[model samples]
Target: MKKPTLRLRLLRSFLVILTPLVLFLYYENYYAIKIVREEVSQSTSNVLSIHITQIDRTLDEITHYLLQQIVTSDTKSAYLDMASLPETNGNYTLAKIKIHNELTSGSTAFENFHSFFAYSVKKEDFIFSRSSFTDTNDLKEMLGEYVREKVKGQSFSDWIVLRYWEKSYLVRVAQASDGVYIGAVLLLEDLIRPLRGLDYGDRWEAILLDTTGQPLTKSVMSPETMTAVNRKLVTNPLAFQVFENPADHKDYLLVSTDFKQAPLRLAAMIPEKSLLQRLPFFQGVIYLIPLGVIVIFIFYSHYLRKMLFSPMNSLIMGMRRVVKGDMEIGLKEAETEELNFLITTFNHMVSQISHLKINVYEEMLKAQQSEFKHLQAQINPHFYLNSLNIINSLSTLGENDLIKKMTEHLADYFRFITRSHRDTITIDEEVRHIRNYLEIQMLRFPEKITYNIDLPEPFSRTMILPLMIQPFVENAVIHGMEEGSKPFHIEISAGNCQEDPNCLEILIRDNGVGFTPEVLSTFNQKKFGDGTGTHMGIWNVYRRMRMAFGYQAEVTFLLGEPNGAIVRLTIPAIGAFHEMEEEEDGKADDR
Candidate 1:
C-alpha cells in the first residue's frame, strides 16, 4: 500500500482530536443555556408566586371588611344603608362617627391601604379614611367630581381601575342593603411597588394583570407589548411567557401567578438579554468556546505545516536524490531542533560514503599496477635466447628428435609467458607450463638436472595467481645450482596442511647448494638478497600471495636435511577453483 504524506497524517490526527473538542464545547453551551433558562424561569415564577400570594391575602382582608361593614352582628341593615332617617333620629350623627371610625381603623390595617369608603347613593353622602401616603384632597375632589358619577354607572361589583389626581387606584366595590356601597381604595403603584425592586435583572417590568390579561396599572413595557403578552397568556396559557416585543425589537420572559382572592395576575417580565446579563461568567465562556477553537485550529494547521510538514517534505526529497545516486545534493538547515539534527546526520553520512568510494577506487588502481608488474617480470628474453641456442646446437649435431623436442619445449615456454597477463591460470595448466620449463633446463644440462612433479589429480582445477610458483622454481634453479659431482635434483609436492585443512601445503626440495644465512634474512625482510635484485621477484610473488590469500599464505626457505634447500609454502586452500569463481561473481555484481 502507498503511504500517506506527513501533512496528511498530522492533519488527520489533528482533526481526530479537534472534532471531539468542538462537539463537547457545543454540547456544553447547549446544556448550560438550557439549565440557566430553566432555573431563571423557575426562580422568577417562584418569586412572583410569593408576592402574588401576599397581595391576594391583603385583597381578601379588605373585601371581608367591606362586607362586614354592610351588615351588623344581627344581620340588620348597616349605617350606610340608612338613607331616609327621621329628623328626630339622633342615631344619624352617631352612625356617621361610627362609620368613619371603622373606615379609619381598616385603612391603616395593611400595606398600601389608602381609604375605606362608605357611600349612601340615595342620600348622596360620602365618607373616607385618610392615611399619611394618601391625598384626601384628591379623594374629596374625586368623590365630588368623578367617583359619584363613576360609581353610579359602574354595573359590576368588583375591583375597578380608578383615577384620582392623575394617579390610578385599585377600588374594590361592594353593595350593601339597597343602594349603599362599601369600598376600599388601594394605591395601585404602592400595592405592587415592592416587585420593582426585585433582583430579577436590569430593565424589568412589574405588572398586575386582570383575568382577561389586561394591565391594571402602569408598567415599563409599551401597551403594544402588553397586548401581545396578554394574547399569549390568554390563548396558550403557559406558566411563563416567551414574547418578542415589537416596540424595542427585544425578547422577554413573563413569569406570572394568579391571585387567589382577586381576578389578577402578578407577573415579572424581563428582557431576554437582561435576564442573561446576570448569569455567571461561565455562560459567556460557553458562547466563546467555538470561536476560540476556530482561532486555535487556524494557527495550529499553519504552524504544523510550517514547522513539521515542510521540513519533512524537504528531507524526503533529499533522500530520493541520494537513492538515485546524487551525492552532490544538500538540504537546508531546519529551524526545528530535532529535524535539524536529522538533516545534519544525513549530510555526514553522505560525506562518509563519498570518501569510502574514493578509497576503494585508489585500492583498485594499486591492484592493477601490481598485476602489470607481474606481467612485465614474467617475460624473460634471455631464457628465450638460451632455448634458441640449445635448439641450434642440437640441430648442428643432426639429432632431429632432440631438436624437435627442444623446439616444442621452447615454444610452450613462450606461449605460457605470452598468457601471463591473466589474473589466474588453472593448476593443471600451470603444472604443464612448469614441466616445459624444467624440460628446457634438462635439455641444457642433460644428466646434470633432474626433477619430479607431484600434484594430486583432484587438485588440478585449483586456481592460483599467475606466475605464483614459477618465480620460486626459477629461484631454486638460479641460486641453488652448483658445480658438483652429484646430479642436481628437484622435487615439487603439494597436499593439505597438517595445521589447517583449509590451507594448501607445498614442499619444493632441491639437492643443490642452499641459501646462506644472510640471503635468507634479507629475503624474509622483503629485500633483494643480492645487489642484482634477483630476490625482488620472489618477494613480489610472496606479496601477491598475501594479497590473494591473506597473511596465512606462508613461504619459508630452510636448509635441506642433508644437501639441498627446502621451500615450504602454505596457502589458503587451492583444492578447488571456488575462490576464483567467487571473485568473478563479485565482478559481475559490480558491473
Candidate 2:
C-alpha cells in the first residue's frame, strides 16, 4: 500500500494528541465569551425594553389626553348663535389648563408637543397652540385633510425623524370620538437616554428605530454602521434578527419589540464587537495556557522528522521527476515498513507509465502519417484539375480579358497552394480568389454558370479558412451542373446567423441538378459509399474544418427543392474570425 502523505501523518498525530488539548482551550474560551456576550445582550435588552415600554405608555397617555381635551373643549358651541355655560366655566378652563400643564411636564420623555388641528363633522374648526400670537390656522389646515382621511377609515400612520438638539421624534395621528383626529409627536431620544445611562462600561451602544424601521436615532460607533443597520432592517424585517455584513462577514444583532398601544417599531442594534467587550479579564489567562504546549511539540517533532519527513522528501523528488518526463525513476527505499511498501508500488507505477508513453507515441505517429498521406493525395488532385484548365486556357485564349482572367485564376490557385505561412485569409481575399477561379471557368464554359457574391460590407473584413467556398463552388460546377445554354445561377450570401450572434453563416446556393436521396445520405455520413468516386475537394474541406474548428464549425450540404443545392457553413465569427481578418488585411496592405 502507498504510504500516507506527510500532511496527513502530521494531522493525525496532532488530532491524536494536540486536538483534545486545543479543543478544551477553544471550548473554554468560546463558552466564556459566549456567556459574557449573552449576559450583556440580555441585560441591555431588558433595560432598553423597560425604557421603551415606559415611552410607549407615555405616548398612550398623550393620545388619551388629546382625546380628553377635544371632547371637553366647548368653544364650538360658545361661538355659535346661542352661547351659554355653567357659572363655574372659568374654574373649569383653569382646571383644564392645569391638566395640560401636568401632561406636558410629565412628558419628559418627549422634546416638544403640538396638538394637530381637530376637524369634526359636528364642530367646524377646533385648533389650539401654546404660543400666544402664533397663527395656528395654516398648520391646522395641513392637519385638517389628514384628520378627515384618518376619521374616514384609514389607520393613522407614524413617521420618525431626527430633529434639532440631536433628538428623534415619532409623529403620528390618533382618533378621538365623533370624527375628530389629533396628530401628536413623541421624542424617543429622551426615552432611550435612560437605557444609555445604564451602560455597564462595555462600550455598548443603544439605538431605537420606530416600527417603520427608519433609524430614529443611534449611539453606535459610526454612521456607516447605522446605515448598514437600516438597510438590513428594510431588507429582512423579522422582529428579532441577527445579520452579518455580507462584504466583511462581521456579525450584527438586531432585536425589535412592538408597542402594545402605539403603531411603533422599537428596534435595537448591538454589534458583535460590543458583545465581545463584556468578557472578563480572567478569561485571557485561560487562553494563554497553550503557550506551555511548545515543549511537547518540539520533542514530538524531532522524532517524527526522521521517520516521516525524510521519506516524504524522497517521494516528492520522485514525483517531480515523473512530472518532468523522467517516468522511469522510482522512490528510494526506507527502513519504515510503510516507506518500503511505497517504494515498491512506485516502481510498479513507473513501469506502467513508461509502457503507456510508448503506446501513446506509437498511436500518434500512425495518425500523423495517415494525415500526411491524406493531405498529399488531396492536394495533387486539386492541382491537376486547375493546372489542366490553365494549360487549356493558355492554348486557346484570344482576347486580352480572357488571358488576363485566366492568368489571374492560375496565379491565385498557385498562390493559395504555395502560401504556407497562413492557413486563413480575409473574407475579401477569399472572395477575390473565388472570383478569379470563376472568371477562368467562365471563359471555357461561358454559358455554363453565372454567380453572384452577397456579403455584408462590414463582414468583408472578417476571416474564414482559405478556400472554404472554392471547393463547394467547384463541386457545384462539376457534379451539379455540367453544361447548359441557360447557365446555372449560383448565389453566395454571408451573414451573421439569426440565432447565434457570435456565429457567421455562409450560404452557397446553385440552381443545378440536385443530389439524389442516396447521395444526400452519403454526404451527411461524410464517407465513400460502395467504392463510387468521391469529390476530393468536398472531403478535403470537411477534413480541414474538423482539424481547425473541431465540431462547432461545420459545413452542411442540403438539396434544395426542384433543381438546386445549398451548402451552409457556420463558423464562430466574433473573436477568431474578426481578429484574424484584420491581421490578414494588415499583412496584405504591407505586401
Candidate 3:
C-alpha cells in the first residue's frame, strides 16, 4: 500500500476534528434545552410554592385569631347577645370593651366589624354582634352536628352569614362550655383581601374552604370544581393534593399545611404554565455561544496555560500556606496586580471579622444585663402592692374568713403574676380571683357593701388573664360606691354575650352617689394624673392588659341600673380552656 501525502494527512486530520465539533454542537443544544426546561420548571414551582405558602399563612393567622376569641368566655357571652339572645345578654356589656381592645391591639383584622354571633344548638336563633363576633342559636344548631363528628377538643372553620352586612365571614368554632359554643367571625373580605393584594395573577386565584370543601369566601369558583376539590379534601382531609385546573384545563399544584399546635388549615395552588414560560428563552441563550467557534482559541489556550493557569496555581498554594498559619508566603508578581491585592485583603478581612465577633459577644452580654434590670423593675411595683395588701390585712384583722378570702385573693393574684408562664388563663380562675378580692373588701366594710356573685356554670376554665376581672371589681368597690347611709350593691355575673363569647358582667350600684361625666372622662385617660396614690391598681391593670393581651382586655365604667356605676371586664376565652370551669364547679360544690 502507498503512503498518504502530507496534504491528504492534513485533510484527514481536519475531517476528524470537524466530526467531533459537529457532534458537540448538536449535543450541547440538546442538553442546553433540557437544562433550561428543568430550570423553568423549578422556577415556576418555587413561585407557586411561595404563593401557596402565603395563602396557607393567611388562613393560619385568621384561624389562630378566631379560635383564640371563641375559646374565651367573655367573647362567648358577647356572641349570645348579638343574636338577640337573653341567656347572657346582661353580661354582654363588656363585649364592646373587648372588641375595641382587640381592634386597637391589632388582634382582629377588620375595622368596621358589625357583629359576632353564633347559632343556638337548637338552630332556633342566630346569636351574633359587631365586636368579638359570637352567636348562640346558629352555633348551637350547626356546631352541634360538628362536635358529634369532630373530636371534642378540636376546632373547625366554616362560612357564616352576618345579619348587619350583605357579606359572609370565615367563622371558627370550638366547645367553650357545655350547651354554649364559642366562635369568632372574620369578615370574608378581610381574609381574602390580603390574598388579593398578592401579585398572584388572574390565573392564580386562591380558594379558602372547610374540610368539606364549602367556599368560605365569595370568590367566584365553578360549582363542579368546588365540589370536586371538597370531595378530594374530605377523602384525605389532612394531606395536600394537586389536580388539573378545572377553569383552564391546565395542571396546577396544590398543597396544605397544618399549623403546628394551632387550630388552622392552610391550602394553596399554582398553575404549571407559569413555570414553563422561561424555558425557551434560556434555551436560545445557552446555544448561542460555542466554546470552539473562535479562530483565536489555540492562541488564547497558550496564554491561559502559561500565564493564567500557573499564577492561579501559585495563588491557591499561597492560600493553603496561609491556612496552615504561614501568612508570610510570597507570590510571584503577575500582570494582574489586583489578584495580589485580593490575597492581602483576605488576610485583613479575617482579622477584622474575628475582632467584630468579640465585640458583638461583649455587647450581647451587656444587653442581657440591661434586659434583666428592666424585668426586675417591672415586677417591683406589683410585688410592693401585693406586700402592702398583705400587711394591711394581717395588721388590721388577723385570721378571719374575710381575711382568709382576701389573703387567698392576693395569693391567687400573685400566683398569676409569677406564672407569667402564659399570656392568658381560664376565665374561671380569673373570676375566682376577682371574687376573692371582693370578699376581702366586703370584710373591710362588712355591713356597708353587699356583694353578689352570678357567674354561669362551667365558664371557669375558658382562657382569660387571672386578674382581668379584679381590676374592674376594685374600681367599682373603691371608686364607684361611697361609704354612706345608703347601701352599696356590687353584682358580678358571667353570662353568654349575645354576639361575643362569655362576658363577666359586673354592676356596682350605690344609692350614695353616681359618677358624673367628668369622673368618667378622667377615668378613661390612659395615665391617671395623680399616680401618687390614685388609680394605681386601675392604671397598672389597664397598661399591663394592653401590653399582655393587647387591647382586647380593658376596664370600662358606665352608669349602672337602679343607680351607681357598672364596671365591665371583658376578656378573650379559649374554647378548650375547661380547667377553670371544673375548678369553679368544685368551689360551688364546697359551698
* Per-candidate local distance difference test: 0.73, 0.65, 0.55
For all predictions, the C-alpha RMSD in Å is 18.0, 25.6, 52.5
C-alpha RMSD in Å of predicted model 3 compared with the true structure? 52.5
TM-score between candidate 2 and the true structure:
0.38
What tens digits encode model 2's per-residue C-alpha lDDT throughout 388-456? 766566577555677676766777667665653455767787788778777776776777778999978
lDDT of 2 at 265: 62
The 10-residue segment of model 1 with minimum total lDDT is 73-82
Least accurate stretch of 10 residues (summed lDDT) in model 2? 76-85
Better of 1 and 2 by TM-score: 1
TM-score of 1: 0.51
Sorted on lDDT, best first, the list reads: 1, 2, 3
Q: Residues 201-255, candidate 1, lDDT per residue (tens digit)?
A: 6678888877677777787777788887877777777778677777888778877
Instruction: Compose the digit string of candidate 3's lDDT tens values, residues 1-591.
Output: 999754456456765876687677678776875565456545544654565466456556555666666656766555545434444555444543454455345433534332344434433343454323344444444445654545445545453333233444444565443444545555555644655565534565565554445555655658876666666666765443456767667775455543332233444555545544546554554455344434344565566656565666776786777667564555666666675676556657656655776788799868754643443345446544754675586567664655566666667767656655344556566666666666666667767777777666666445654455665666566566765666677776765555575443333344435568888787766555533456656665565555544566656667765677766655555443355546655665776
**Top candidate when judged by TM-score against the true structure:** 1
